[model samples]
Target: MNQVSSSNASLLGATFMLGAGITFAIINVITPIVTWQMGVPSTAVVFWQYVIATVFALPLIWRIGFGALKTRHPVAHEVRAFLSALGVQFFAFGFASGVPVWQMVALSMTGPFFIIAGATIFLGERLTVQRLGATIAGFAGALLVSQIGSEQFTWASILPVLAAACWGTVSVITKYLTRDEAPESLTLYMLVLITPNHFLIGLILGIAVAILPAGALPASLATGFDFMLPGGDALVLILLLGLVTAAAQYFLSLAYKVADATYLQPFDDLKLPLNIIAGWLVLGQVPGILFWPGVLLIIGASLFIMRQDRGRLPTGRSPIPETA
Candidate 1:
């Protein structure tokens, strides 16, 4: 990034940033369609999505070879990979439970707060007053966005927030492991291990679904865990979902390669509005009036954090990796 002039690199990174935001927005909109409208189980949706995504990521893994697997923190890699897989599952389950696309995306923004909190407790990282205040506001914003006491709120609303926490914790561990492990090693470990985590978890869910009494669980919890892919157009949509997931990750990597993470923070925030618009246009999932207050706090707090960390964290070193 330092090799290129600031203006040129920032422009290039912004372009990729836009591309990534667009792709993830597409992902957000398509997910609920596949899980709810199409009747495919969320378990199967997450499983196959990662499998197809791995297929898209194969070329990079091949280029890097098994050498990328060499790491000083194998256990940490496994834990992070598993948590990332779990995060994807929780996000899928949110859609399956009918959380509107916009709301889910909004809740996902709480990740950085979790990362900061986790870093402070687990990594002994400093928690500045500004960061602590931002973290509190971020969670407060999440609570407002969640609309806990409103008739619209459901237990499902927690899933996206949980997903964010999972991914954020993954980022925390990545911060620890990256002290000695290469970034490529982390990516390689994720690509190789995440799908198995998905598969194993899916299998367990399938067994539980089959064996658990019919009325034992809530209606939402009782949704079948399907191992089979959906037929016809649903299959096509899931395939596209995987392809775009890889595309989003690729574009994010490109953006970080060319420009600083702080420089691209504003562009990253675009995902919230992009997903909101996509939900409104594609699914008529308009966010309620309360959504604005929460979203504002989240974006504002994130921008404030980025400003504070400008020279400290540096490029390619942001704790919140979207891919994680």
Candidate 2:
């Protein structure tokens, strides 16, 4: 491809990634609000949330089936992916456990840190000083935004951090495994294989928490769906939310093909501000004063990573190879 074509492709990919970031940010903002409105426990809410995602994955799997599995270790590699996904699911579930929303947003920004650490450990990638310093600064911002000194800390807070580590590992592993596989195949395998594991866990947790001595489960179930014509609006909203999420994932996949990961990743920092906006618009929850500084720090750190990665590339290097 010529320079003009490459630039255009990168621009298109960047646009898609921005869309994905916005959708994810909206999901992050609205999910907790939904859980609170539904009076469902965080875990239950998360379980249902994944159900929507799982539903979205089904059509994709149907579009590409066992034929693609022939190229990869259908069982083992899928299991690895699923396990990583489980960690992410746990993070989603923990989002509601009374932890402040702003704190969750700030701490989760450390995802880049874990991602960088994972690359170093798993892929033997060197950690540049700029990236390392930026990672540390990101966490410092998290601490400030979360007000670690003032708020009570609990195990729940650790889940997002662990999720980031797991996701980071997944990224390296995914890159390794998908060396010769199609993106459609990997996504399908992840959703189909991972869903069962998540479903089983959700079932166990749902039952465990539902059967509690008190009428908590019954109450949640009572308000769960309403199961009537009136609930059509709710169902439509859920489906729409899921569609938005799936669209985001699709765009992210497209972005990967057109732009370097480092270049595209810094754009993900857009999620924080978008989340704050979505929260305020949808749920009337604006971020606190500390959030502004924390967001700036995260953006700065992400930009540093992008710059460091770009610095390593050969001059005039293009992100995508020319077909002809």
Candidate 3:
């Protein structure tokens, strides 16, 4: 609908969304190989990804200068960054745990539901009929994808669900911050703060691991507490990760600039399939059958939520960690 489309075909927006999809698919595919296979710590990967992104953003930082850092909402920014960094860590852990890419991506779609509920609870927004229904449907979809009672299900399988909740809470906080904070301040604060938050969390975890005996924590939990920098092929993949992360963010900016979110919803959902296909091709991971039906419901709920939320927030500004 032109209600969301800025132009006839919304071609530019669709193209940018597609570009983001491809890059995110690459990120989803490679993260596991770096953590699950190459044995890089998940926290290290999360820290470096933001560090690399910060490095990439130096010019913009320099251009904006220190004045952009003067925000009254410093604590809010810190909390948001903490939550966001944790979401990134959880996502990496899920990937490292070898959850099928499609399932992870599909489950991540539940973020919108949390966002909606948070808006109603925290932001004092009304929960309309459509959004309430969408939230239920979305969670139902997530449950199907999760397959809670299936033998294949494990604690690691739920990490992305936790990630979705964290990301959604961050989004709600972002919405609250937007009431007063400038966009530049928010972006600058996030870039500057996320890395340190990640490092601190990693440090605490590493300390805990050291204090505890061997086998105290599970392999997935214990794997990423070290301070090691990746080398050789792992280093190259992480660098590629940094590059694509920036590219995905850029594409999101471009896409959101043109098409309103409701119009771009379908294109954004392409990441699920793109990640799924990439996983099958590169990692030989086949999605469980639940993925098909689960993804459909998730997509439907996301579209409905986006449609209902069309004008409440800034257009094209996604708080979900689709780029991360």
Candidate 4:
């Protein structure tokens, strides 16, 4: 009976991971294709993306206890989480505007590094040497992808790095807040709280781009919200992307809730290959030899972390503290 249950759990974990990988890959490809092909401003595209994501998430929110956001001390943890989400929003838009899914997803592979830093600093956890080495290797790969060669480093290459850092922060923050809050409640707050924050960011960025001098906009930012709709096919793709986005967030929150950071961390490495494949299928992206090495570093680091969980928590549904 125990063996059967363990097998079942492993199957479920694989299913959840596959679902996450496919959804995220679809979103990454859809965002860029919609904005680039449809002639919609990047900001406008992002605005509609968030709007659609929120709408799609609504049914799930209602099915759960979303109204819990109205409870006392609502602003305490939720606000911080919302800010963390804003960083994710910026990364989403940034990738959509400038980078391909290959680079965006590749850079995002560095998230575990930020996770380790956040765990050590914010969650009072100790950092492992393996994690540190892996992070350094992953960052080095990022530097290469960004074209940060000896004498010519561009800001464009750096933005994705910042975006990955933000992603790591989101994971840590989610882990921290999910301690007392149920997964449904935490996801609910994230949806409701982040909606306004992202909306305001879109609005402000839109205004900034419009008012900025001609060269200023391109040199400093790529705005997406230009008050135009993508074509019919593009519109359809965006809607589908929204649905996928909603599901991904829900599953990710659930995973964080039901598992420890160390146990579940290895799964996040799956995104690297997923993105690589998406890039190949959608954009004819062919990664060079350097890409594989960097991916290996990220994956190796995640496995090391997972290996450390050998005896600390049970194999399935371990109630390890989410504070990290």
Candidate 5:
């Protein structure tokens, strides 16, 4: 592609990614509400979302043919799928546990720092001073969100941080696979592998809840396994959750195809502010005063990293090293 075309494609990819981030933020806000209304466990909700996403992607799989499923890096795909599933579980647990939307979003910002560190340590990418500074600032923001030395500090709050770390690992592995794999294939295989895993776990959790006494299971598991059949509006919202999540995943895959992870990482912070707006508009929940400063630091740090990384690569081209 010519320079103009490349730039346009990158712009398009960035736009899609921003839209995906917004969609994800919306999902983050709504999932808890739906779970509360239906009294269903987080695992059940996650299982259904993945099933719907898998069904939605069936057409793409058919068009691409069975050949798209063939990959020499099966083990890598397996590992990535596992991490992705674990990340989803953590996110669901965190949200269902009643972590505030803004706080959850802030904690999730730790992913970019994890991505930078993973890229440097695992993928042999350079650790620039700007990236190091950004990572430090990002963690500082997370600490602020955690409200250390305050009454809001709870062990349950750590789930989103762990989720962010898992996602960061997934991001680096994804960058590695993208060197030789199609984005569609990576996404398809991940869904194909993780969907069943989530479904099985949900089933197990449901059975455990049915057979075991309430106090026997861990509180998080107990809360996440509190399944109830949805009716009316709750059912509709659950279906929408699946659809939105699927589309967001596809957009993210496309974004990574057009740009390096570093270039795209900053935009992930968009979800924080988006979540804040969503909470205010939909739930009448405004963040505490400390949230504003922390969010601004996170965004400002991300922008600093983005500015430092730009112009190092040509427009619309990925910075990932080519593979054999």
Candidate 6:
């Protein structure tokens, strides 16, 4: 790719990433509320969301055919799907557990740090001093936002952090796969793999809820495992969840296609503020005093990492080597 074409691609990728961020923020806000309102289990919600995404993606797969799906890295796709499923399940659990949207969003800022760590460990990327410092500061911020010393801290608060870690692993694997795989193929295979996994998990959980004694299971899991059929507004929201998720996933794949993960990762920070606004408008929730400062630290850490990378790379391209 020439400089001009690369610049254009980067611009397009950034736009796609921005769109992904926006749609995902909406998803973050709406999915939990929809799950709670409909009394659907988290795994069930994930299953439907992916089922919808797979349905929407089938046309593209039909156009591209089976050849596009061929890859030497089937194992990689499976691993990515597993990690992504774990991340999605954890996130859904966090939201359904009554953790505030903004707080969940804030903790999710830890994702980039985990991404950096994954890149370093798995991708053979070097960890610079600035990156190390930024990662530490980012975690410190997360700890502050967690308010562990306060009575408000609960195990539920940790779910988003686990989600972030899983997502970060997915991001690293994605960066690796983008070396040879088309983003569409990667996205398609992931949905194909995980949709069934989620359904099976949901089914098992539903059965457990039916068989187990009332006090046997944790309250959160019990509530999350309560399977209910959607109706009325809940039905509409369920359908929208699938469509919105598919769109978001597509945009995200497009973003990774044209740009390195490092180049696009910073744009993810936009979701926090977006989620904050969405939380206030849609859910009437507001962050407490410590939330703002913690968010700032997280954002600052991401910027610092970006700046360090910027100084090392050429003006228009990433220094990170692409694998063949």
Off by over 4 Å in 6: 1-11, 178-185, 203-216, 223-228, 258-261, 309-324
What is the lDDT for 145 in model 6? 88
Q: Estimate the TM-score for candidate 5.
A: 0.83
Cα lDDT of model 6 by residue, 108-199, tens digit: 76888998999999889998888999999999889888877898888889988998898778878877887777755765676567776566
Clashing pairs in 1: none
Give me the candidate number with maximum lDDT.
Answer: 1
Each candidate: what lDDT? Answer: 0.82, 0.60, 0.79, 0.62, 0.72, 0.74
The parts of candidate 4 lying over 4 Å away from their true place are 70-73, 76-81, 128-130, 145-147, 150-154, 210-214, 219-224, 253-264, 309-324
lDDT of 3 at 208: 83
Which regions in candidate 3 have their CA more than 4 angstroms from the true location?
Answer: 1-9, 212-216, 316-324
lDDT of 2 by residue, 37-71 (tens): 64444444444555566677566657767676665
Worst 10 residues of 3 by lDDT: 315-324
RMSD vs true structure, all candidates = 2.2, 6.2, 2.7, 4.5, 4.9, 4.8
lDDT, candidate 3, 1-324, per-residue tens: 654454644889899989989988999988999988987877788777767766776765676577988988888889988988888888888888877787777787788888887888988999878788888888888888888789877778788888888899988998898787776677667767777988988988888888888898878777537667678998888888887777776677668667777788888888887888898999998878876787788889988887777777665453333333
lDDT of 6: 0.74
Q: What residue pairs clash in candidate 4, if any at all? A: 41-224, 42-224, 42-225, 43-224, 43-225, 44-224, 44-225
Q: CA shift at 52, candidate 2, in angstroms?
A: 3.6
Candidate 4 lDDT trough over 10 residues, lowest sum: 315-324
Q: In angstroms, how far off is 30's CA in candidate 2?
A: 2.9
Put down candidate 1 lDDT per residue, 10-116, tens digits, no spaces. Answer: 89999999999999888888888988787688888878887898899788679768987877777888898888888888888899889998889989888889989
Which scores better on lDDT, 2 or 5? 5
Model 3 whole-model lDDT (C-alpha atoms): 0.79
- What is the overall TM-score of model 3 with all chains considered together? 0.91
Per-residue CA lDDT of candidate 5, range 236-284, in tens? 8778888887777667766766766556766756766778888778867
| Tens digits of per-residue lDDT for model 4, 1-324 | 488875665556656756677777777777667655554555555556666777977776687764666544476455555555555555555554556666667666666678789888998877777767766776776666554554434455455667667656766766666556555565566666665665677677778877877767653245535545566887787678667777776666556444444556567567767877887898887766566666566566657656763565333331111100
Give the distance in Å from residue 47's predicted Cα in candidate 2 to where it truly belongs: 3.7
Model 6 TM-score, all chains together: 0.83
